[model samples]
Target: MSEIATSEAAHPAHLQHHFDSLQEQSQVASLGMWVFLVTEILFFGGMFTSYLVYRSTYPDAFAIASKHTVILIGAVNTAVLITSSLTMALAVFASSEGNRKSTVNFLTATWVLGFTFLVLKGIEYTIDFHEHLVPGAGFQMAGTNPGHAELFFSLYFIMTGIHALHMIIGLSVLLVILYMARRGDFSPEYHSPVEVMGLYWHFVDIIWIFLFPLLYLIDRHR
Candidate 1:
């Protein structure tokens, strides 16, 4: 028992002063991340509820507005985000396996994919501007109540804009992780940062998953 205790006392360099063991540290980090995620869910939940109310109040207008959205761009961005999530998962796996090269490769791929999504989104926004879909003065829609249609556009801009902001933040975090990864800052036993970042990336991707169908596919049957 004394020998076991002595061996356990030898902490890894990555272990913080507040943590007694790697396991304890990992648990704390994971718990913190989950708590943060819960708060994020609540934050987004309010907007979602607002969306539901507005959508319900103006279903026809919402449907018409959704039809004007760039479905092709939304679909392509969805695919990009999903693929990025897969790469992020691979990055976490590589980190856990102590393969620095693989981790860096996968993280780079994820970052590139995220950047591509943003570029495509920017193009979509430019198209929206050209189409006069900006939801205020100069906004235009046909065969629906323009006021309700404007509301739909308002929600569209707010939801998707917030989502893009999260994507940018996620990409920035990935950049920091990539730099640290290149420096061999992580190991199989101390890759909690990578794991937590993966959680965040996945969460962002999931948000887009919801947004795609809501914002793009609501009027497909028409």
Candidate 2:
């Protein structure tokens, strides 16, 4: 107990007054992030449930709409996000080791990969718009069930649009973290921010992992 108290007293920089020690602070931060992510999961869960319900109701239409999605771009974006997750992990690891240079480099790589994903998605969205997939007066899909197909596209846009927003936010946070790393703000003893942001980034990547097959690979064998 004396040793722990001494260590905590030594590192007053990042330790909050409310927390007894940096370890305690980091644990609380992780718990808070988990709680926040749970709410996020529930929020997304509603959309996923809606998707399942509607997809079951209109399998044929959903399949047809899925086919219209740009699978190549979707696949490439998946790869990009998956790679970004790796880079993010490396960034966290580097921060934990107090390797400032590696931390910055890895975070930059993750940011670049994330930006690439959004850019590819932008291109995909453009193609979708040109193809009249945007569910409106100009919407067009060659099928007997254009109404249901539009519904599929509607969900697709909402889910992915919100996801893209999250990605943008994550990128912004990454920039902040990168700046901090450049300033030597993180160290082996104090890198919780990097670690916590890594969790958020991974969660975002996992969402895409589920989304790719559901939105782009449905009935592709046909």
Candidate 3:
């Protein structure tokens, strides 16, 4: 514990005097990070499991439906998400270094990248909608396996919908943290909000990572 304290606290302000040592703070932060990760896993886990069930049941429908999705768009979005994750980590690193300017720059970059991902997602959905790929919105498929196609698309929308909801919530939280960073509220000693937000942002990226392969990779088996 003393070792942990020595490593984390470069100054008194960084180590909460009330907490006895930096080790305690680090331990608490690590614990909280793990708990949050569990919830994230559970969230995406449900989606992944559901997708497998449907894919198993409607193999051909799943394959054909996947073709309708813009694989290139999904791939580009994945790359964008990866860049956001990088910026988020860099922002956290900036906070640790107490480089307020760098921290703000990184945060702003991350926020912009995240929004770009959303915009790309919107365009993808638009394409899906125009082609009648959207489920429950006058969705259609003709010949061969229209019934199974609907089932595949239904699962696609539900999973992606939940993921998009998470991204919006994450963006809101990130904006709040961004505001705080601008106010000079975060520092090496006090950056809980940024750290937590980083956890959330990373989790969202991971969810999309899975989503990309599941939705886009079904065709590879053929």
Candidate 4:
């Protein structure tokens, strides 16, 4: 504990001076970060539950909508995002070990993969638009489904649209982190910002993992 205190004392003013120890600081930061993640899960949970309820109520609509969805594109995006998560993990590892150069390289790789994912998502959205899958904008009216077919497209747009917004936010955060890294703002001792951001990145990846199977790969065998 004394060694930790000494390390904290020697650390820079950028870190909170109120914290008595670096370990405490890290623990608090991590806790706060995880709490934020929990809230994020809740935010998405509402939509997921709504999807389930609607799917059950309108199984035929759900199946037809699912058929129109590009599962292949979703699968490719999943691969892209998982690869980005791996690189983001490596970036955190590099930061922990004080290899600033490697950290930068890994972050760069992550950014590339993130952009790739976004591009593919954009293409998918465009295709959906062309296919008249969007609600109120030329919807195909998935068969004579018992329930409201329009509701299905509405839910689809709401869910996927919110997710895309999150991706944009993540990309912006990564850019800020990259700029700071270029400026030597982080070191092995006080890269809590990077660590927190990494946690967020991984959480987003996990969300997409769930989304892929539910939204794309589902048999929707109604």
Instruction: State which candidate has the highest lDDT.
Output: 2
lDDT of 3: 0.84
lDDT of each: 0.91, 0.92, 0.84, 0.83
Once fitted onto the true fold, the runs of candidate 2 whose alpha carbons sit more than 4 angstroms away are 1-11
lDDT of 2 by residue, 139-169 (tens): 9888648999999999999999999999999
Every model: Cα RMSD to truth: 3.7, 3.2, 4.6, 3.7
Candidate 3 residue-wise lDDT at 26:
65
lDDT of 3 at 36: 78
Which should have the higher TM-score, number 1 or number 4? Answer: 1
The alpha-carbon root-mean-square deviation between model 1 and the true structure, to one decimal in Å, is 3.7
User: Number of clashes in every candidate structure?
Assistant: 0, 0, 0, 0
lDDT of 4 by residue, 76-171 (tens): 999999999999999989888878888899999999998898899889989988987777747775366524666776777788788878888999
lDDT of 4: 0.83
Clashing pairs in 3: none
Q: Is candidate 3 or candidate 4 better by TM-score?
A: 4
Give the per-residue lDDT digits (tens) of candidate 1, residues 90-206: 999999999999999999999999999999999999999999899889998889999999898898899999999999999998999999999999988899999999999999898
Off by over 4 Å in 1: 1-9
